[model samples]
Each structure stands twice: as structure tokens, then as C-alpha cells.
Target: MSIVDKVRELCGTKKITIAELERSLGLGAGTVSRWDTRIPGIDKVQKVADYFQVSTDYLLGRTETPYYALTEKDEPSIQADLERLIEDLDGLKYSKETEEFSEETKELLIASLEQAVRIAKMEAKRKYTPKKYRGES
Candidate 1:
């Protein structure tokens, strides 16, 4: 499918609105709408790719395995799973600490934090489902 098609499908499935994408990507509403209409410019392309955690090629449907592959229904499921995992891990046990430390230790901590965020996002994506609410009646 074309990038526009893929984007539309992904958004529609996720219940993600154009306005939400625009706000998240810090673009004008028309920006994403235009993307929905047609292939966007490189900069706009990059913004969406970054937000979705996919490569520009993948966003363009140039890759088979989309790096960021989650439908609208997928987002909430992923989020719920991630939340559960975080809860199980006792994520609230500690806040990010800013302690005086050697530059190496600080860098390591930063790397760890980044990895944590990536893991959380991936976990959410893996558990995401485009259909069925978590606790809807």
C-alpha cells in the first residue's frame, strides 16, 4: 500500500486523529491532512516516521516489516500491557534521581533511561490491538 494508505489505515485503526498526529508531531493540521491526501515532503515525512518510530522507507511502504507497526486498536492494548508490566515491575518505586556522579555513570544512567523508554514503547506496541476495548461495556 502507499504511505498515505498505510497511514490512513494505521490511524483509522488506532483511532488516532489527524489533529492528534499534527499536535504530536508539532505540525500544522493541514500538514498531516496533506500527508493523508498525498505523500508529504521529506521533513514532514521524517516527522511522522519519528513519531511512529518507523523509518521513512517504511512509512513510504518501501519496507515490508514496518519498524513501527501498530494500528489504532493496537495502541491501547499496547498501552495497557505496558502499564501492567510497569506496574508489575513496580515502576513507581523510584523516581529519576539526579545524583552527583562521574560523567561516565551519568551517561550510563541516561542510556539506561533511554533504553527503558524504548522498551516500554515496544512492549506497548507488541500488546496493541486495533479492535476491542480494554474494559468497555
Candidate 2:
């Protein structure tokens, strides 16, 4: 099915008309319905995805699922947590008095950053991936 059709299906399921969707999205009339002839810009596509709690890939027909399973942290919260993690890893506590850092210190810092990033990725995947799909993605 076309992305337009998928969108129409969601509209029906939600009991909203295309005009209502456009009004909610602040888009011009027939904006979404035009997907048949043209792909929307990234911003517009994201608006639709966010509205439906689905992924952009799903709207593009790349995935059968509408959205990833919700985790404890949504996107905004996850970003905030990641920022905090980065700050913890590179905060002034790690700053040496001397301008130059020893090779060992550099390696340790790099390793710590790598491990933190890996853990974050794994946690995210575990939370968002459907239970049955697991590590497939």
C-alpha cells in the first residue's frame, strides 16, 4: 500500500478525517494525501510519525510495525540521560592539573567513553525492540 493509504488507514482507525489530521498538523489541505505523487520533506514526515507514535521507516513502508515498543524513557528523556552520561564521563573531575595528559589516562578515558556508549546502545535496543524481534534489528 502507498504511504497515503497507510495514513488513510490510520485516520480511519483513529476516527479522524484527513482534514482533521491536516488541521492538527498545521499542514495545508491535501498535504498528506499528496504522498501518492511525492514524498514529503523530512520535517513533515517526522510530524506524521510523531503524531501516530510510529517510525518514519514504517511510514515509508520499510517496516511492518507502526512503531517501536515504548521504553521507560521516551526520545526526549533518553537524550537528556545521554547528555548527563556524557557530562559524567568528561566532566571537570577527569581534568588533570597539567595541560598534557599521559597516554594511559587517554586510553582509560577513551575506554570509559566507549563502554558507556555501548551500554547506552544496548539498553536502548532492549527497551525499544519488540520482545519477539529481540536482537534482529
Candidate 3:
């Protein structure tokens, strides 16, 4: 849906008309309606979103859900997992591999390992996020 549609829907929920919304926003009549053909600035978009108590992305129709409360603990939890995995992998016998792996190759391998761990964490969260109190971004 367009910004106009979102605003209209919000107006309905709030029991207000487009003109009333514009007036409430200190915008001239038809200002909000004109947004259908003309994209407004970030400031205006934020204003409207704030007024309606919705995210700008939601008003812009970027997402179906208006809110996604992420878990505040996810970051630290993921970090802890990564640290443990890295510590475990550090003890692995890389002598044979290191003989062939140049300094550059070693760095690349380390980076790749870190990235894989991050991806794994993300996948786990995406597939099995059951905590309503805390969500991962």
C-alpha cells in the first residue's frame, strides 16, 4: 500500500479524516493527499509516522508487520556462542593445513570461520526464534 493508503487506514483507526489529519499535523488541506503523487521528505514521513505511532518503514509499506520487538539478549548470546566455537576451533590441528596456507590464506580462513559462525547464529535465530520477550534483529 502507498503512504496515502496507510495514512487513510490509520486515520480510520483513529477516527479522523484526511483533512483532519493534515490539520492536526499543521499541514494544509490536501498536503497529505498530495503525497500520493509526490514523495515527501524524511522529516515529513517521520512526522506522519510519529503521529500515527507507526514506524516509517511500516507507513512506507516496507514491511507487513508494524513492529518487531527484537531480543535484547540475542547479541550477547550470539557473541558468547561465537567465542566458545572459536576457542574450540583454535585447538584443532591446523599444522598440515597451515603448511600450505600462506599468511594471507590463514587470515582468509579465520575471517571465513567467523563469518560462518555469524551466519549460523542468524540461521538459528531465523528458524527457531521462540522468545517473545527477546527477539533478534
Candidate 4:
């Protein structure tokens, strides 16, 4: 089943409105509405998945078991917890160097870092210099 189908199933006897989910989760209505057709972001998917105590894979129709299910009304605390978990995981992944990175992946990483360095230098210049005296773009 798709994520929308799983979310509807979890709603059960009561109807779960998209607005309710949006408001409770502090997300835009369009974001939830898009889930009706497109693949959701990890954060949005995690919001629904966290509410149902299920893994994002399950919510995305990639798995079957509901990992940690909760109610439709649990968009707040559940989303917060899920976001925290995601952030923690991201931090760990970014900090750790992989034993194996494909040539293409390594090249892409290098390119991205080069752009990031340029952006950082620009930002540092902006912070230290007076606006009127700053170098032209």
C-alpha cells in the first residue's frame, strides 16, 4: 500500500483531514496534498510515519511492519522526535568518512565542497565588511 493508504488505514474509524495534519505538524497544506500523488520528503514522510509509529519505508509503501505506531493526532511530539532522530542520523553520516565511495560520488562531493567553500567565504566577507564598502558581486 502507498503512504496515503497506510495513513488512511491508521486513521481507522475517524477521518483524518489533511488540514489537521498540516496544522498540527506546522506544514503547508500543499505539502500534504502533494503526498496524495508524489513521493514525500524524508521530513514529511517521517511526520506521518512517526505519527503511526511506522518506519518511513512502510509509510512510503516500501515495507509492511508498523515500527512504532501512534495516533493521527500525534503530529506534534511525534514529528519533533522523528526530526531529531533524522538530524542525529544526518550528523553521524556527514561526519564519518566512508570506506568506499564510487569515483563519481567522490567527484560530486569534491564539486559540492568547492561550491560550499566559495559560499562560506562570501558569507564571511559579508559579515566582516561594511555593506556600502563591500566588494561588488
Candidate 5:
């Protein structure tokens, strides 16, 4: 969907007109409607996003999720799981004289694992959380 369409949808949920939204954000009249034909500045988009409590990516149609809660990278349970998985990998012997994962390879694996875990946590929260609790209308 276009940015204008998304804005319109959000406005409808809030029972506010586009003009009201513009005025509330201190934007000029018809500025948001004009986004249908003109590319709006990032600052304007960010302002609208902040007002709506949604991500700029959602307003820009880059993502379907509107509100993505922050994930804790240092969650004790997740970190413990990561460590256990790494230990399991280390326990596997590729060969008597060869290491299964070099230092650089281990670093890369850890980074990838952390990223995957973060995404998984976000998706789980988004999927399982109720719409009212998630701030969705």
C-alpha cells in the first residue's frame, strides 16, 4: 500500500480526518494527501510514525508489522540455550586432529545465532500477543 493509504487507514482507526492529523502534527494542510503523488521527506514520515506509535517502515509499506517491541539480547534463557547449542557443536569431533569450528567461524556462528534468536522472539511476540495488548486497533 502507498504511504498515503496507510496513513488514511490509521486515521480511520483513530476516527480522525487527514486534516486533523496534519494539524495535530503541525504539517501544512493537504501535505499528507499529497504524499500519494509526491515523495514526503523522512522527517515528515517520522513525525507521523511517532504520532501513530508505529514504525516508519510500517507507514512506508516496508513491513507488515506495525509495532515491534524491543527484544532483549541478554535474556538469560536465550543465552543459556545459545551456550548449550554451542557446547553441543563443540562436543562433535570432525576429526582427531582438526577443530570443528575455528575462532572466526565460532564468532560468525554466534552473531548469526543471536540475530536469528532476536527475530524469532519478535515473531513469537507479534504472533501470540493479543491485538489490544499489542496496541493494534
Candidate 6:
């Protein structure tokens, strides 16, 4: 879906109209609607993403997952986690010699671990943050 479409969909879920969202964000009239034909500025995109509590990647349709909130600084930590997990798996001893994971399997495992970490972080934020501080009621 287009950025405009995604924004509209999110507005729908929040039970607000596009115009209302524009007003809430202090944007001019029809700014978001124009995104269908024109590429919006990064600042505008970020404002919309922040208002909806979603990542710009989700708003831009780069990712289907709306809440993958990992930032650039978190990338190194995720990589380290993946490496440590892989090493732990490799270190495990079995009755028979353990076979090494295929490259594809390793990739899948890393992706799964990354996603799991993202979910855990999101959950922690939701659980620990005060309701007044969150976007939701």
C-alpha cells in the first residue's frame, strides 16, 4: 500500500479522519492526501509515524510489522545477541557430534531472534511506561 493509504488506514483504526490527523499534527490541509501523487518530505513522514506510534518503515511500506522500534544504536546489540545465541547453540554437546546449521538455517534463526528481541522490547516499554505517556488510552 502507498504511504497515503497506510496513513489513512491507521487513522481509521484510531477512529479519526485524515483531516483530523492533519489538524492534530498541525499540518496544512490535504497534505497527507497529496502523498498519493507526491513523495512527502522525511520530516512529514516522521511526524506522521510518531503520531501513529509506528516506525517510518511501516508507514513507507518497507516493513509489514508496524512496531519494530529498534533504533540504529540497537543494531549492534541485536547483532551481538544473535552471535551469542548462535555460539551457545554450537557449544551444546549431544550424544552424537552435533551437525553445524546450514547458512539458510542460521539466517532464519537470526531473523527470528531479531524479531523476538524487538517484540520483547516493545512489550517491556508497554508494560513499564505509564499510560499517560503512551499514545494509547
Q: On residues 1-137, what C-alpha lDDT tens digit does candidate 2 reach at each position?
A: 88888888878888999899999999999999788899788888778766776677777888775545444545565556666765765544435564565678767866676566556755665456653453222
Model 2 deviation from the true structure expressed as Cα RMSD, one decimal place: 13.7
Evaluate all candidate structures by whole-model CA lDDT and list the values in order.
0.61, 0.70, 0.70, 0.57, 0.78, 0.77
TM-score of 5: 0.51
Give the poorly placed runs of model 5, Cα more than 4 Å off. Answer: 69-137
- Per-model TM against the reference: 0.43, 0.50, 0.49, 0.42, 0.51, 0.52
Candidate 3, residue 82: how far the Cα is off, in Å: 34
Across residues 1-137, which tens digit of lDDT does each residue of candidate 6 receive? 99998998999999999999999999999999999899899999889988877767878887775553455766787678767776786654332446666678777777898788767766666456553444321
Model 2 reaches what TM-score against the true structure?
0.50
Which numbered prediction scores highest in lDDT against the true structure? 5
Tens-digit lDDT string for candidate 1 (7-49): 6666776689867877887887677556656657899877776
Q: Global CA lDDT of candidate 1, please?
A: 0.61
lDDT of 5 by residue, 55-91 (tens): 7788887778676554454387667867777787666
**Which regions of candidate 2 deviate over 4 angstroms?**
69-137
Task: Rate residue 119 of model 6 by lDDT.
Answer: 72
Q: After superposition, how far is residue 3 of candidate 3 from its true place, in Å?
A: 0.7
Worst 10 residues of 3 by lDDT: 128-137
Q: Which residues of candidate 1, in runs, are more than 4 Å off?
A: 36-39, 68-137
Off by over 4 Å in 4: 13-15, 68-137
Structure candidate 1, residue pairs in collision: 13-72, 13-73, 14-72, 73-129, 73-130, 74-128, 74-129, 74-130, 78-124, 78-128
* Two-way TM-score contest, 2 vs 6, winner: 6
Q: Which is the leading candidate under TM-score? A: 6
